[model samples]
Target: MMNGIEAVIFDLDGSLVDSMWIWKDIDIDYLGRFGLEPPPDLSREIEGKSFSETAAYFKERFSLPDSVEQIKADWNRMAWDKYMNEVPLKDGVGEYLDWCLSKNIRLGIATSNSRELVNSIARVHGLEHVFQCIMTSCDVGRGKPAPDIYLAVAGQLGIPPRACLVFEDIIPGILAGKAAGMKVCAVEDAYSLEQAEEKKALADYYISHFSEVLQG
Candidate 1:
């Protein structure tokens, strides 16, 4: 679909894997244990932040007794288990990746998720070999909407930002890619389809599924 795209960058959680919804459940279940409930905007606030950033947001906002590091570790443990056991690749992602490989386009992942969680999911889905580089927001000083993570991934791949096409599921990620001077394609998965049009407004392109890219 991209005529001269030399590299493709993907967002892990909601774009490549169907695990975004699990986070909401995890937050509700975990907070309930402490007799607390997250605010309706909690997820939105943390959606494009690193693990520590998200945990710190929760800690301060909810007045949690645990330290930010402790909350991050706890959340990671819970998320890693769920991801390794239950998250599945979105339909046609594997095939689309194979096509990119065949076309000799470099592939990389730029995510706000922790490295451990990203590795666990890649290992479980046998995608460790598919991506040339997998970068987490923690690797950079900032997360999505800041452009650092995406720019880092492009640098790692030895590709200029304009030569890369980023596939994102959230508005922050789309903004990040744009800020990095990369073309952005918004991927509509179950979690983001309701706001697909809104996301598209910020993206250069939009695809309902990976198959749609292949068909193009």
Candidate 2:
């Protein structure tokens, strides 16, 4: 049950929110601007990378002419509407957040998303104040699977890594939390259906929905 965990760290996209779908679309359209299509492994290729890192990957992979800032700006522009208006909290996440708040457990978000996109989602969902701290990959200067972002969030929350419990949907995110010496729960996301088993194996716990953790 991961007893003694004092704080819960969450990954925004695909974990607490259903925003993973938007990224693939963004990648496809972003590459199309260079008259190219998203590679079949595009999602895997950019997994665990920060916004700027992803942009750098795109530029070099496609031989694009735009600078990293230009590419990041373009992605932000393309993703703004969907993140603001369409993305919804993952099933049972709102209730889970309420549970955490009631229990006085600290909350922190360690995400690969840009600060703008994360803020937009948090604002729309009225979740801006629920967290004790919010940290982006940009803030850490590195992305998930590297442990930097997770460590940064833990540091901001003033919680020891072993006292933090992380919920993640992707392999990279799970790895990041574990690397930070935290207990990780791999949550289910249809977008990553193929990696469901792999995620289960890597995580300290596995649940199909946040509700399962609550129910227990």
Candidate 3:
């Protein structure tokens, strides 16, 4: 509903695909391997962090023996398997992307996930070609809630931050978009709706489904 928005930037994991719940399973299984239970707040801590940041947090919090890269690789192996073989797009996202394309709105992806992970899921959903740019937090010096990632994406798209709209499902992503001075549309997912409502009030709009985008 924001006027004069020229581009749309999307968050990959829970926003575009139903993969957040998969992370919970990964956390439980991975921690259980060492006879440890996942800390209650583990999911919240990692929700908006970059892969490397998350690994570091896990290592420190769990006293894990693996190096950060090793831990990340292990997590990626399990995640990629789920993403490639099991994850599905959030309902109606493909149609919504097509609608945006038809409107000639530039599109980009800005995610805290690694580039490999984002590309894998985008490829599985046939969305690789739909985005003008695919930017990962690794490409920037900081991750979500920092504004750096979204600012980089806007720069890549040749759009002013005020002229861009961001679609985000998590608090950190929404805050990042807001910090970048863009209009944000908070998208709801099974795992994030309640948290989004309570913690992401900075978003300019809220939609439970991508289909809501077509209503404009």
Candidate 4:
């Protein structure tokens, strides 16, 4: 998979880190403050939205009293401790990162998550220097399924779009990478397990663990 790849860009949640499981509980607890429960399709609706966009969505959808920025802050506060203590690198990710470093492959992060949390993850994992570039959808004009963030990361890494390989765990993310003219590898995550077949169809490759890439 690294054949002609110059850079590897990873989506933060679910892709590089096993953090997708934290969100549903956060949503439940956050909305519980208002005595509201998330609709069953809430995750689907916000699948590819940027952090700012998701905050705005909650404000409008739930008739929230907080501003968009406040909503985002609340989420960051709610998820902070969990991210630091609970989230972990996906299987074989450590080895894969080492391999990439050994090959002198440029590494980057293109995520839809908040910068605060992403930075926190990097610092906690001692990955502050691991990636050459880290970008958020909030910094770009649009979020996943739009290709803006992915393209931006590739540009920042000074690598061509086609030379960057993206690891993603959701359909919108896979679509975004493809739209950016990069090869996308669909990652398996319990949060998106139901869409496994579709992800496989959309991505150039699919793997349940990062170890699969090393084996190939």
Candidate 5:
């Protein structure tokens, strides 16, 4: 489905790693520190937000006494071990990235996650040198659905928007890529299974794994 992809931009969380399932547990546990349970809308409220943005939201939403930066620090400490040791690269991803590297295809990461967490995962996976650019919404002004993150990635990669292919697992990330005038490929993730059809409809293509792009 991709026709003019000179570069590939990826979303990190659900797309690159099987890490989403652990987030709800983190949220519950983090809130439990303050003797609170996660709110019913916790997932919805945090969806697509930058790491710092989410921390601020949590502080305000739960009336926590901690400052935004402190909240972020606490969560980062909680999540660092999981990201470094337990997060597995999604199926076929390492091979695909290696293949793309051999072909000199520029790769970049544009994510809502913080730079520290992204680095932690990269270090553990030994993928620190793979991406030409690693950007977060904090580097730009907004998160997904605003187009800023993808555009920033393409800009730094020195590729035109139309020459970039974005791989994402969630609707917001897909829309962000499309909004930036890039071709988007929606990847399957069990956490987002309910929105599979919506993802395919919004993306330029949909694939179960990165190897599908090699076949294409």
Candidate 6:
């Protein structure tokens, strides 16, 4: 997959870390504060939206009394502990990162997660200095499926889009990387396992673990 790749970009939550499981619980608890339950399709409806966009969506869809910032703050507060204590890098991720570094391949992140949380993860994982560029979709005009954030990361890395390879865990994210004109690898995540076939079809490559990439 790295044949002509000068850089590798990753989506943060599910693609790079095993943290997708926390969001559903957070959504339930956050909405519970307003005596509301998340809609059945809530996750699907908000898939790939930036943190701010998701907050706005919650505010509008649930008729939430809290301002968008307030909702985000609540989520951040709820998620902080879980991320710090429960989340972990995906299987073989540490080795993969080291290998990439040894090969002098650039690394970057293009994510829909909040910057505060992303930074916290990097610091806790001792990856604060590993990535050449770390960016959130909030920095761009649009989120995943639009290619804006992916393109932004590539631009910051000084790598051409075609020379960058992206690892993503969701359909929208895979679409975003492809739309950016980069090769995309679909990563398996328990949260999105239901879409496995579609993911495999959409991405240029698919892997259940980062170790699979190393095998190539």
Q: Give a tens-digit lDDT track for model 2, residues 1-216.
A: 547978999999999899899988887777777788887988898898998898899889889888999988888899999998889999999998998899889999999998898888889999889998988998988888999999888998999999999999999999999999999999999898999989989998998878899777
Q: Against the true structure, what is each candidate's TM-score? A: 0.96, 0.98, 0.95, 0.99, 0.96, 0.99
Better of 4 and 5 by TM-score: 4
Candidate 3 structure quality by residue, lDDT tens digits, 60-96: 9889999999998998888888889989888888998
- What C-alpha lDDT do the candidate models reach, one value each? 0.89, 0.90, 0.86, 0.96, 0.89, 0.94
Maximum-lDDT candidate:
4
Residues 1-216 of candidate 5 have per-residue lDDT tens digits of 545667999999999888988788899999998999998878877888888889888988899999998988888888888887788999999989988898788999998988899988888888889999999998997888889999999999999999999999988899899999999999999888989999989998998987888898
Stretches of candidate 5 exceeding 4 Å from the true structure: none
RMSD of each: 1.1, 0.9, 1.4, 0.5, 1.1, 0.6
Give me the displacement of residue 72 in model 3, in angstroms: 1.0
Tens-digit lDDT string for candidate 6 (1-216): 889999999999999999998999998888888888988899999999999999998888888888899888888999999999999999999999999899999999999999999999999999989999999999895888999999999999999999999999999999999999999999999999999999999999999999999899
Give the per-residue Cα lDDT of candidate 3 at 170.
Answer: 88
Of 1 and 6, the candidate ranking higher by TM-score: 6
Give lDDT: candidate 3, residue 101: 88
What tens digits encode model 1's per-residue C-alpha lDDT throughout 1-216? Answer: 588899999999889898899899889988997998878778778878987788788888888999988887888888877898889998789999999999999999998888888998889999999999999998896878999999999999999999999999998899999999999999887776768888988998998778988788
Lowest-scoring 10 consecutive residues by lDDT in candidate 1? 188-197
> Candidate 4 at residue 171, lDDT?
97
Candidate 3 C-alpha error for residue 201, in Å: 2.8
**Model 4 lDDT per residue over 23-79, tens place:** 999999999999999899999999989999999999999999999999999999999
- Flag clash pairs in model 4: none
